[model samples]
Every structure is written in structure tokens, then in C-alpha cells.
Target: MTDIQLNMDGEPGWEPFDAPALVGASLRFVSGDRTGNRFRMRYFRNASGELVARVWFGPETEGPPGHAHGGSIAAVLDEVLGLAAWAAGYPIVVGNLNIHFRHLLPLQTVVQVDSEVVAAAGRKISVRGRIVLGDRIFAEADCLCITLPEEQRRQLG
Candidate 1:
């Protein structure tokens, strides 16, 4: 389903769509499973209009015997960065993503994620995102999203 089809009703903000709902819907769109029980992601608007989302990794997302999986971290980065672009009013596909793994993130701990739009050129959008635990950063990513034309996005459906 497309973004329009996944439109959630009666959102809290109720103006330009709730950021958390939008992210949750997009996660459901990509992952195909909405636990809706635990491991919630909260959203809020920054001064620059970027929608930030945070997820606390726990029993729900585990790998490597004890900590979060590498893929899971990337997924969160990509999702948040893409949502950053989409929230900026430019829907796009993943182009390139580079992440730096700094620390071993513990499971069942709160990990903060923040994404912001840096620049847009034609069909490309550059964004930056980071996953942080308290004052320490676990991973950081810089992504390039390929903006799709209306026709291309339509074809994906």
C-alpha cells in the first residue's frame, strides 16, 4: 500500500499528519508486522520541521546473542532518514547509505534516533541520522535518497 492508502485516522496532532503515526505506518509498510505492544517509537517535531523517531531495542529486536543486530540498526537509520525526506515533502527511494558503528549497543536500552534533511538536488536528497544512548553515540549514517517522479512512485504500486 502507498502512503495515501495507509493514512491513519484521528491522529493526535491532526494537522499535517502525526510524525509518529507516519513512521509507524511506514515501518508497517516495509516490515509487514506491527507489534503494537512494546518497543514503541515516539516522535516529535524539531525546530527545523524534521520528524525524529526513537526506538528502544529490547527482546523484540535482538541479535549477536545479546545486542542489536547490525541490520536492525541500518533499518532504523534508513527508515528514519527516508521519513525525514518524506516529511520534508519529497518522497524518494534509497540511493546510498554509509554508517559508522562506534559502540556496541545494549539490548533493552533506549536508543535515540534523530534525522534531518541536509540538501536536495533533482532526484537526490542527502540526510544525516544518528543513534545515541545517553551521551554516547552507537551508530551514525549519512544517506542519499533518490527522489522519484510521480510516475515512478505510481509504478511501484
Candidate 2:
């Protein structure tokens, strides 16, 4: 039997990050199933402390034959981008996510999601991210997030 690769914390220069620690089960829809075939996601922080994710789109996420659905891709972006804000110490909820699909993503392929917190203005935070495999960019998104109030933030956790 072949073992499924479910986690990536041991990769060089990457550290394991627990999103559930911050938001409880709020991110469960996209990233919750670690062993399921729908989506397999492993969260990490690179050497620079930037949030990154290794995500696999399984057969259940397919739209076109052999390819993943655009909605599936967008959902991953929404979760990761919003988590990017939380990882950067801003407890936030995604208000808007603008995505541009550049290429079709094949199901069962692992791709990297790299995210950055670009700007912050009072209660608002902007995050930019991409789903890519090496030099090939599959999708890119800019997420607008709003900082949650202290009470609301505590409730999320």
C-alpha cells in the first residue's frame, strides 16, 4: 500500500502552522479534510514567516473532465487569503475575494498557495495570493478583509 502524502511540515525552511488554533472550525470547509479525497491541505510558514499552503484538488473537486472547478479554486483562495491576514496578527474576516483564473488546474495535482498581506488601513486589510506550480500560474486573488472586533474575534476562536 502506498502512503498518501498528507502533511508538509518537514520540508526545509517551512514550519507547521495551525489555523484552527486561531479560528477554531471556521476554516473547515476547504481545509478541514486532511485524509479525505475532496481536498488535502497542509499549512506552513516559510522561512520569512509568510503563510503558504500545499493543496491538492482531488477528483471530487473536478468541474471539467480531469480539471478542478473554478469555485473549488476560489474557495481555497478565500480560506488561505483570509488566513493570511490572521497569520499576520490581524484577526480578520474576508469581505471580498477577487480572483483571476489564468489556467486550468488539473485534479489530483498539488499546488502552492502563496499569500501576502499587502496593506492595512484601520479595520481593513488587503491580501494578495496565487495558486501556482513552479512557473505556471493557475489563479491569482486579492482578498479584502475586515478586522473583527475583539468580541467577535474571541467568538471565532
Candidate 3:
């Protein structure tokens, strides 16, 4: 196995005292040894400690002619919501995610996924997220997350 930093790799103090330590060891930026194009997620934890991710649609991810794929949109939304919830000290797996596509989102346009936790009921957490193209709302999503033990979640963090 190759060695990588558990922190931001030379960027000082990204892991604050208040934030739960992320155990991913390292985050992936590129697909290994792939020939054609592939999707890559850009992420950052916002001021509210929410994990936000964005991706520009690829040609293969077309749903209608040049429009972006609905399935891709849903997957991004789910990923964002799940990360946001986990960053809030509760590492969980996405159980169910419901997405509503309101418009034909275009390809090559950057789509932003913003997510936040709405509620928590025992082992289940309710998360809501929105996919936006600049000021326009492209889709809305809600998710139910099942709490995972820290030991289990930390392994893949």
C-alpha cells in the first residue's frame, strides 16, 4: 500500500479540535489507470461544518440529449447529504434517498450539492439537500441515514 497523509497533507491544522477526526487516511482525487473520462467529486467542509461536493456532468452521464443524468444527480445529492450527516459526529450510511428533478440540468455546467441535517430519530437521521446550478435550483433531495458504529465507519473513513 502507498503512504498518504491522514490530514490535509502539509496544509496545517485542517483538523480542528471541535471537529471529529476523519479517518479516511486519504481522499481520492483521480481514478487509477482509466483511459476515457470519469467523474470526480470536489469537496470541502463549509463554515457550518457541512460537506459540500460538486461535479461537472460528463458526456456519458447524459439523460436527455445534452442534459445531465438524473441518476447521477441523485447519487451526488446522496453523497453530499451522507457526508454532511457524518461530519456532524454521526457516521451513517445512506438508507434511502428521495430526489426530485425540477429541471433539465445541462452538461459541462458545475452542479453544487449543499446538504444539512434536519432531524435525528434514534438510529435514523433525516437529511435534506439541494442541487444548484448557480442561483437556479436543479433538484432537491431527502435522505434517511442509518447510524453506523464508529469502529465500522472509521475503517473506510
Best by lDDT: 2
Candidate achieving higher lDDT, 2 or 3: 2
The positional error of residue 146 in candidate 3, measured at the CA in angstroms, is 0.7
lDDT of 1: 0.70
Screening candidate 2 with a backbone cut-off below 3 angstroms (N, C-alpha, C), the clashing residue pairs are none
Q: Looking at candidate 3, what is the lDDT of residue 24?
A: 51
Colliding residue pairs in candidate 3? 24-157
Residue-level lDDT of model 1, residues 63-153, one tens digit each, is 7777888877888788778888888878787889999999888776656777889998888899999998668999999999998888976
lDDT of each candidate versus the true structure: 0.70, 0.90, 0.66
Superposed model 3: Cα runs more than 4 Å off:
1-36, 149-157
Each prediction's TM-score against the native? 0.76, 0.93, 0.72
Residues 1-157, candidate 2, lDDT per residue (tens digit)? 2233743333698898988887788778999988788898888999989899999899999999999999999999999999999999999889999999999999888899999999999999999999998899999999999999999866665
- Candidate 3 lDDT tens digits, 25-126: 222322121222334455666656666655556676688998887886776676667767777767788899999888888875656677889999898999
Per-candidate clash tally = 0, 0, 1
RMSD (Cα, Å) for all candidates, in order, is 7.2, 1.8, 7.4
Distance from true position, residue 95, model 1, in Å?
A: 1.2
